[model samples]
Target: MTPAARHAAAIGILDRWLAGEAAEKALTNWARTNRYAGSGDRAAIRDIVFQSIRCRRSFAHLSGAETGRGLILGALRAAQTDPATVFTGDRFAPAPLTDAEFATETALPPAPSGNVALDCPDWLRPLLDRALGDQALAVLEALRHRAPVFLRVNSLRATVDQAVAALQAEGIDTRPAPLSPRALEVTGNARRVQTSAAFAAGLVELQDAASQAVVDLLPLTAGARVLDLCAGGGGKSLAMAARMSLQIFAHDIDAGRLSDLPARAGRAGAPLHLLDDAEGPERMAPFDLVLADAPCSGSGSWRRAPEAKWRLTAERLTQLCAIQDSILTRAAALVAPGGVLAYATCSLLEDENSDRIAAFLDRHPDWRCDLSRQFTPLDGADGFFAAILRRVD
Candidate 1:
């Protein structure tokens, strides 16, 4: 497709989104009906649509209107691309810009402030401010970009040097991430990662550097009984297994969320015992380590899903806090005396991170916080928090 045609396609998708249709659904429907678009064309169009959405307010202002045409023009201008060359009025290209459109290009809309400036909802500004302080804007700006692909070197299977060599053999380049000893940030051709021989041979698994650091902080030993209470997809569970020959028991309140664990475990050569809610008290036991990787607003992942920042509501955040609290309480009960309980979240909000841990410690006076740490997107990884607590008899 011509560059002009790509812009036209993006405008079409943006129009559907503006009409209240979901971004993914609109993009998918467009792709399905346009079989003439190749994989590269589809990916390019998708990037244009997502980039526009990520900076909707700013793009709307620059483009002079919030319509599809305006957004594409604004996005192109923001990227410093010459629209006249692309919108050349050629076959399959967008129409030439009118005198009115050209005249109005210089008269941009007012710059949004506070939440709107960040492309986030108004209700969330205060919370984000409280959580991030003077660095809030930097954090929000970081979200406007894409996240890097990180892989955790399965030390049990291969060393970092060995994994990097194997991955490089497949034309994949990587650099060591400073955040975690076991992490390697994919530098080039990251999209081919799933098909790389290194991945196929179980030498590496896709994981955030912050997530790997969180697991590395835990002191796991052979023969230890561990319970991953909120083990969604069992990423950490599998990582922990690779760290030691531990008797790992993974569980989630919603068992269906863990449906991929068996297959993922098989590929990683890690053994994990999956427990369903129906397993009941029969599986209840004092575990040496109990981990609750609770659900949250997913603030850490905004770089990958910019739409979530606009979709978050005050009420939804409050509900998430309550759920996190409950999970901490329930998961703590399964920790053996003298054992440790680890609580974690991907949220950058203090209320969802340290605050929840503080509340739990208040309720359980006998448990002491062993260690706690938080990371932000600017720190070279997704924002995350993890607190380790030891139960004292």
Candidate 2:
């Protein structure tokens, strides 16, 4: 498809998204209906739609409207492109700009200010400010763009150097990420990573560098008994297995998330025991390490899931915090005497990170936090928070 047609397609998808359809679902529905569109066309349209969502408020202010057309116009203006080229009223392109639309463009309003300019929700600004402080704007600005792709080298299958060589042979270039020794930041042809020999050979897995860094910090010993309390997809469980000889048991409230773990673990040569919610905690009790990778607002990952940023509400955040609290409380029980209880979240909010840890420490006077870290976009990885607490008595 032509570039103009892609933009037009993106506008339609955006309209569907604005009308309460999910971004992914709207894009999927469009793709299914428009079977003539090629992979490249679909990817381009998806990018345009996500980018517009990432800066929805600023784009709306710039285009003097909040419609799909306005967002596309604003996107073109932001890119310093001539919107007339795309909105040519051609057969496949968007309709020509009206007199009012042209006037709005000519008399573009002054730039947005504060939260709007930063592409943050007004209600979320204070929370982000409190969490990020001086780095708030930088982090928020980072979310307005695409996130970097990172892969974790599975040491069980191949060394970092071997994995790099294998990936390079497949035309996918990667460089070491400072955040974690086992991480490789894909530098080129990242789209081909899944098909690369390195990935097929189980030498690498798609995981955020910061997420790997969280596992790197864990104090694991050979043959350590570990429990991943909220092991969604078992990413951390795999990472831990790669690092050392671990009797790893993975569990999630929703057992369906762990359905693929057997295949993934087999591919990576990592052995993981799956557990059901009814008896997993009791059977796996007294573990040396228990990781609670709890759910949150996903604020740190807004760049990849931009729609989540706009959809999150104060009520939802409050509910998530409550859930995090409950998970921490329950997971603490499964930790053996002197064992470590790790709390983690993919969020930059203090309420979900540091504050939650503080609350946990208060409730469990015998357990003390030993280490805590927060990873942000500034760290060149998705934002993450992890804290290790140890039982004293």
Candidate 3:
């Protein structure tokens, strides 16, 4: 498809998304219906749609409207391209810009201010500022662009050099990410990774560099018993398994999330046990380390899941904080006397990160936090917070 047609397609998908359909679902539905759209066309259209979402408010301000057409027009303007080129009224192309749209070209308002310019929700601005301090604006700006694709080399299977060579042979170029020794930021052909021998052989797995860094901080010992308390997809469990010879058990409130973990563990040659409520993870309790990678607003990952930023509400955030607190309290019980209870989230908000940890410490005065670290986009990784608390009594 021509570039113009791709923009037109993106406009349609964005409209569906604005109308309450999920971005991924809308894109998938479009793809299924438009079977003629090639892989390249689909990818290009997806990029356009996501980028527009990331900078939605600023784009709306620029185009003088909040509709899908306005967004595309704003995108073209941002890229210094004329909208007339894409909206040519040609077959399969977007219709010519309306008179009002033409007027918008000259009557664009002064740049958006404060939260709108930052593309951050107004209610979230204060929380973000509290969490990020002086770095808030910079981090918010970073979320307006695409995130880099990172791969974690399975050290148990292959050396970093071996993984790089294998991926390079398959046309996927990568370089070491400074955030973690095991991380490799993909430079090209990232889409081919799933089909590459390196991935099939479990030489590497797609994971955020900062997430890998969080796992790196775990104090793992040979034969240590580790419990991933909220092991959604078991990413941390698998990472820990690959790093050391440990008896790893993963448990989640919802067992369905672990459905693919067994296969993933097998591929990576990691020894992981899946525990359900019926089996009781507490039955194998007193774990040396328990990791609670709880859910959150996902503000740190807005660049990848831009729609989530717009979808979040104040009530939802409060509910998540309550859930995080409950998970911390319950998971702490499974930790042995003197074991480490690690809390982690992919959120940049202080209420979700530091504040949650403070609340946990307040409730359990016996546990003392030994270490805490926050990773942000400014550090070239997703915003993440990890704190290691050791039981003293």
Candidate 4:
């Protein structure tokens, strides 16, 4: 498809998103109906849509409206591209810009502060402030951009050197990430990675460096019984399995979320036992290590899923924190005497990360924090935080 047609396609999809449709679902539905769009076309359109979402507030201010066409025009303008070239009104192209649309002032819009200004939900600004303080603005600024793809070399299957050689042989250039020993940040050929020999051979798995670091923070011991209490898709579970020869047990409140984990574990040569919700506390409690990679507002992943930034609300955030607190309470019960419980989240909000940990510590005097660390996207990876706590009794 021509570049003009791509912009037009992105405009249509963005319209769906603006009209309350999810970004991924809308894009997938569009792809299914428009089989004429190639993989490159789909990816390009998705990128444009996400870019618009990431800078929605700024773009809306510049373009003078919140519609899809206005967003596309604003995004193009932000990139210093000539909208006239792309919105040529030719067949399959976006309509020509009206006089009012073209009459936008050259000066940038006045700064918005807190949530409206940051393009984040109002309720989340306070949490971000509490989490990062003066760095909150910088972090929010960094989130209004693209995320780099990082791969973790599953050493259980292939050594880092072996995986690097394999990926490099497939025309993908990657550099070792300082955050995690197993992580490699894809510097090039990310488009071809899915079909790369290294990926197909299970020598590498696409995981953020920070996420790898979170799993790395877990103090794993050989032959220990570990449970990933909220192991969605079991990414960390499999990573932990690769780190140590532990009897790994994976469980989630929604069992369907883990349906792909068995196949994924098989591919990565990870041995993981799946526990259903029906399993009683008596049977599953007393684990040496319990990892609660709990759900949250997903503030850390805003760069990748920009649409979620606009969808978050204060009430929703409160609900998520309550759920996280509940999960931690339940997960603590499963920790054996002298066992460690590792809590992790991809949220940058203090309420979800440090604040939740504070609450947990307050409620459970028997457990004490061992270590806590957080990684921000500005550090060239997705934001993540992990806190390891040990039971005294």
Residue-pair clashes per candidate:
0, 0, 0, 1
Query: What TM-score would every model get versus the actual structure?
Result: 0.92, 0.98, 0.98, 0.96
Residue pairs in clash, model 3: none
> 1 or 3, which is superior by lDDT?
3
lDDT of 4 at 367: 80
Q: Candidate 4 residues 113-201, lDDT tens each? A: 55655676656677788888778888998898899999999988999999999999989999999999999999998988888878877
lDDT of 4 at 382: 90
Q: Specify the poorest-scoring 10-residue window by lDDT in model 3.
A: 104-113
Error of 2 at 267 (Å): 1.0
The all-Cα superposition gives candidate 1 an RMSD in Å to the true structure of 2.3
Q: Write the per-residue lDDT of candidate 1 for residues 1-393, one digit (tens) a residue.
A: 877888888989989988988889998999999999998898889888888888887777676788888888877777778778777888878888878777765564555566655666667767778989988889888877778899999877799999999999989999999998889999988877898888888899999999988998887878999999989989899889988899999998788989988988888889989988777413667899998999999988877776677677888889999999999888888878788889989889998998898898899898889899988898899998899999776
Write the number of the candidate with greater lDDT, choosing between 3 and 4.
3
lDDT for model 3, please.
0.93
The lDDT for every candidate, in the order shown, is: 0.85, 0.92, 0.93, 0.87
Per-model root-mean-square deviation over C-alphas: 2.3, 1.1, 1.1, 1.8
**1 versus 4: better TM-score goes to:** 4
Ranking by lDDT: 3, 2, 4, 1
